[model samples]
Target: MNYKRLLLCLLTGYTFAASPASAFQALQPLHEYDKVSKELVETLEGIHYNRPNIDDAISSKAFDYYIDALDPSKSFFLQSDIDSLTQYQNSFDDALRNGDVQVAYTIYNVYLERLEKRLLDLQEHLPEMVKGFDYTLDETLNTDPDKQTWATTDAELDDYWRKRLKNRALTLKINGESEEKILTMLERRYKNQLRQVDQTNATDVYQTFANAITSALDPHTSYFAPRASETFNINMSLSLEGIGAVLQMDDDYTKVVRLIPGGPAATQSDLSPNDRIIAVGQEGAPMVDVVGMRLDDVVDMIRGESDTTVVLEITSSKGDTQTSKRISIVRKKVKLEDQSAKKEVVDIERDGKTYKVGVITLPTFYSDFAAIQAGDKDYKSSTRDTKTLIDELRKENITALILDLRNNGGGSLQEANALTGLFIPAGPTVQIRDQSGRVTPLGDTDATITYSGPMAVLINRMSASASEIVAGAMQDYGRALILGDQSFGKGTVQVLQDLDKGQLKITQAKFYRVSGESTQHKGVMPDIAFPSLIDKETIGESALDNPLIWDKIHETRYPVYWNIPAYLPVLEPRHAARMAKDPNFVAINAQISDFKQQVETYKTVSLNEKTRIEQQETNKANELLRENTRRKALGLDTLTSVDDIEPIDEDTFAKEASEILLDFIATNQLAQQQAEKKTAQN
Candidate 1:
């Protein structure tokens, strides 16, 4: 049969014998044969992915499956690959069953060679296929093979097989060796790994293949497995079980990306972003070594029921090992309100006068799609919530407003439009273009302007998507003075298209500001940029392994422009004067510098002597925190203790943002007074 036809046949009518009774069901005879046939068919046909037939499809599939087999806990492989590879599953069983090591080695070598070649092809083709490709995988393959090093050549493969047999023999030495004894040991290890496969979850496999296809087409397009979908829902809703931290596997370690406020990890007073999880242990179970494991498998191990304890043995970037005390936290459903825009009033004393500036902390631009689709009465959304907050701030008669969007990873397009509309009069907010060259305008639906007085927006590398939209609109219209580091350049818009049984989050369009500048790879640059504490050595779209390049479209017509020549010239000098004396800013820059150095050094740490390396990391973190506290005190925002540095309302970036806005407003007011005096004199 032709490859395409074979794939269609396999997909259309494939079914397992039945769901296993428990997580520990043994592999049935002939089941292996059935799986191998399906895999071989899929491999030849190339129909496993949503947008298949790409050159990388076969290689991507091989890499994915091989990774899955090695680290079953966090592997991202399709159910099809598992089912197809089943025929070869009994290769180990048959060899050990009949005391045939040579046969087993030969079978493993064939699969291993195919996988290695495929990975090499994937690495070679990636740069040409994708723009701004970082070549991370290629670098990884060249630098380290870890356990996979044993399967490189025929001799190495034979040696690995021999070692496995020798290990089994050594274990049975005390008990005296029998064919059954060696076979049982091999079977137990194989079954233990297989049980972690989660065969029933087809969504897991489908999403991996789908994401690879979408990623190949463009970075914006993605596929979310059922678990990922659930996680997305939790993120959108602003809550999740287990540790309240975002994680990604970097090399062999699962590193902390971001920590959610009020979440167990954030509240624990010990867990930190950039910490590497080396091991994971459930209550009453031996800790499992998670080093060099796949991200998905690690995630599976970390997720559990509410109030259940999972110990995370972590190592810091500086190589300090710290065993986190078993923290007991009841996983509670976090509402959108909890993670939405939180407003506060900051009183700053400048030149013997008190200035009340309104600070609005926007954690994320979240929208409840389920409630909105159902037309519910109380659907919490970013635009709606912020509008209400703006009205309340206006009621308080605040002098100015600072919109804090630092670390916000973007959300709904509607919210971005509405939020921008609050500052600018009714007009086109942004323009979007599709793959087929179709242009669509997304405009402001509201007429009422909110907080038109002095405004400033805060952004950083993590501030992306909807955050970029709002910042871009505000800058384009001269509505708000942009502050902080460059924003995360993620302007692409994705639509979750529901298939018959699954869904595809395809990159349907690319968003551009009213001025026609695309926030693709080059994010929004701030008007008054502040040094960021977070290291950007490996952050944002530009820093990703493979990212799309920045592009622009025709400018959308919008009737808005702020003549800030007089204001900007004077604002720069005044802000420069304050920055010189700002101890907090000085300290923050130093910390940022230190962090960059640490990141550069961290890449070279050896896996051997992990315990000693981890200790150094802990010491570095504690010392940094202490220095930051001292700096904070010097600036009148001193944190008394490290514990006092609560994740709650305590954002140094946001705090500095209020001062930045105050400075901007002060400069503008001074310029306005001078202009009026000149008019009077004339």
Candidate 2:
């Protein structure tokens, strides 16, 4: 079937049910098995993939999911496609049951050929195909204004990408360098740097193809070939045996964005964000040129058994270049507890009175899915962990609590609901409506309330999904004050549907707060808004290309809790007055303005001279340090050098939020006391 025709049928024939309650009943486990069997056969036979054993295993799993999703009972798949796809089921089963690698490989090759042809056809019609498309690729490459070039046409984009790919390939092949010579050079270069160099051409091609496919899908989803997959799993499990740093390909150079605390890099205290990696080596070995290499391949070279030594040649964000300096440390698991929420008591002394505030920083709403599925009694969920922390804070006489949800992408819906229950009384937390107009009311069954004091939620553009839910619910109920920049604005709910044996996460429904407002395109707006340093114009769902439109649904029933007046007559003026006098706020605003100017003037530097580039980088770093020192002198925390500000801790910002909440609470209490006095006098 043609792609367009199949999509049309699926869209028209499938109905989005009202709620999971009614729709879930129709889904049967047996139907899932049947669908799985069929998809597995078709995928194997049609694709003609090589490596039958791996193909069958993957396809079988993909089919199970595909069937479950298409099963009208469980999902909204079109019946016609389901019926047509089923015809190949037996063939897939036969291939899998027989372990036919050749057949699988053949199927895969055929599919790949078709895909290539389609892509080429699209390229031929590029100009017409992308007519009126408004999206622009993020200009992350240009750091200097004069060297920047923008492409607005599809043809231009296609040509640009093609050239980029070709250039990368040339770098890998060393430009007409003989295979034997190339291998020799690579081995000598990385002899001391890497454990081994897997210089196979096949490995390079596979990685390139995988990267291309993943880029086409989205920025997040990626295909990690066997060895790469093992590395990824290790990282996810927080059990890396090397320096704790996440690396990614950003143009020609591999950039470091995160440094896991307590890791070798973090302990060394030399490596910083945006630092370019130039060469790598181990003890008594020559440095290898890692520039222009695939990120995964470079990563493989970096990882090793614990307590082993590796040398890294790094170019600091500033103009200074440095060698490894022989920093060594024992590699240990990045304990999940390291990523867990941490509580701190921030005492704010204002007008001769000390106000004790509790600040809780939640990095991510992570849960042990494996343990949960296994029905482990002690499965760790965010809600349970947060509840324990809240109890501890309450005992310490915390008058207000600041729930810092910055950079928290989100996790399970069950935990979102449970966390919401902690703030508000037992009630409907959110409404989930599928395509069929069925609405499922997910509520909090727990009767206990954790913190009932003044509360404020700190979020930025990165906070999304379950984080949005909790923020939206708290705002709707007037139970907490929402502060910080606009949220990530992801209100859609994705359900992972198993395709034959593979997995497909589809946007099955839209989420609405108890008050019936969808947090889709319009994220939860803060009651008291603050300017953020990050660029919101380039972030969030609204900034995405071809994103789903924002809309609303019928309201759900929930009791109105707090009735805080919108017009905080004295509150706004008081905040304005305070901000005017606050040097920290003034400095923050200035820094934000400077960053905006810098971003606007961004261009690519073309200097081939190392000395010139080094000087420029040094100057820029010095300027940044000077600006940071100035801000610090103005009552903000001071950093002596740029290295002091390695990984940004949004906790300081969260503390600022807690102070704002305290101001609001104090003003409200004062007003209430005045009203009571007036009544008594009358």
Candidate 3:
């Protein structure tokens, strides 16, 4: 199968007889589970790219993953509980090979017990605790689990819970929540968590264990149970009736992973990647705290009939104080047309001259496969749409072009190849190395150049997969200048294989640039870097667990269009000079620096209400000052509060890129004239 299918589509036809057990059974393995486990092991060992040996090393890592997945915050399980399970640390390999997973069920059973006990205790005293919290107490709650150790005794664990609950209460109180409201919300949250623990089943434990095993192989590899497979399929369809954002469980919080192009969250809401979703609410209903809730249940609550509204309370990753705000979105199906490539022309004034620059914004490298298979000559694809937009922009006499691929999570592989060909003459664009060490070079065969002009490609941390292929190709060819932050660094291809019970997504191949550099981990580096609002520590491929290493293969022979380094010396200094005085750039750079300072300075949340309120007020004041600074620089009326700041232009990066392109054009003309003069003198 082509790489375009990548992880999203499934290969069906394989089937196995399953036991007639209820969908939700007691926390135990089914009669047919042993056979399925054996199949899973065999498939992973035989077909996976790594062909990993299921030995003590893998078993040890898998065990750690299993325990961490259940208790990521290390709240319930104690050191004693871990000591008891230590014997099974190296036994997972043997159990999986021999078609047994009793150890997995055993560990899950212990986790359930711990969870139930903790939730019950919270339920019993949370109301009283909420009302009795001494807001002036000098204490702190270490939110970073890695910085704290597990409690050794029941009293220690109780103290930990007390601090956690107090921190929660103080945060709410500082946010203007009444004690009665905090009591009601917290009581319901703990009760719901307790019920979820009681409803744990065999399938739940099995899915977690299987995924732990697969994820240990690579971050992209995963196992999906039947119900999870259905949810995955709905996500792939791009028509799920929801806010259209991918949510993943991060510790006890639901975090937004990525926003789907053309989706409601991407188009309408202020939702952003790495933002933690604290709560969800329906129209006219009270906000439901989703902390510690099962991800499936939260998804169910957020998704509803089309044309309805869903409200989310989110804390942005960029925030210093971790304060939350609510945003409402109207649920709707993500339409393909909304994601299509579009273009506009901007006149950039440089050296007292207005240069018409064309900007083509491609949200994704999408292709209508159905239309192509139906032999429709007028099929829509990124390459075709981009070519059309370029023709239209050429009519406007645009001097240069900018392809804005910011936040463009890629789609079709073929589209990336063809789109690269539009700027350069046909050549190898990407190399695919399969599991068997077979390297296949794929590129555009038709020797046709659609847009041969000065160009720059803009990318950010969210531009990934096919986007990397195109960006890397452009950089390698020296046909276009790459600008913005480093890309999302996802260069491997994965395919979903149907198993007897659940599906296994296995990484089957690796992507390499034509220059022989693997984009698996390092992604494409920009010619000129820009300050990114996205936190690199929380996002990108390098932040993931068990990410594949970056390596290289033999470089393919291709003609370089221009020597990009020669132009960078002239362009970089001018660009830097302009950005130094630009208010937006100054503000963004300050925010990034302040974020780094805060990360180094504090790792805990204060439980004292006074400390928290003071921190919150200081953060709000600083935010307002930054906004007013930008407003004053732009000659606009200064905002009294940060809330008065209107949404800024999304094309700010593209506009700056156009100015850089003007510099490049000027430098190129001067170089050509000097070369001609030298030749004439000789």
- State the C-alpha lDDT per candidate: 0.57, 0.55, 0.82
Clashes of each: 21, 50, 0
The sequence of per-residue lDDT tens digits that candidate 3 reaches over residues 487-564 is 989999999898888788889899999999999988999999988878887799999999988999999999898899
Off by over 4 Å in 1: 1-212, 223-240, 244-263, 266-275, 282-286, 292-301, 305-309, 317-330, 368-379, 497-503, 564-580, 606-651, 680-682
Please give the RMSD of candidate 2 to the true structure.
15.2
Per-residue lDDT of 276-379 in model 1, one digit per residue for the tens?
Answer: 77667787875565654556667777777767777776755322222222233444444555677788888778899887788888877778899989989788
**Residue 196 lDDT (model 3):** 69
Give the C-alpha miss distance for residue 334 in model 3, angstroms. 1.6
Pairs with steric clashes in candidate 3: none
Per-residue lDDT tens digits for candidate 2, residues 490-579, read 887654444443333335567888888888777878777766765666567776433445667777777655554553565556666665
TM-score-based ranking: 3, 1, 2
State TM-scores per candidate: 0.67, 0.61, 0.94
Worst 10 residues of 3 by lDDT: 7-16
Stretch of 10 with least lDDT, candidate 2: 19-28
Q: What RMSD does each model have against the real structure?
A: 13.5, 15.2, 9.3
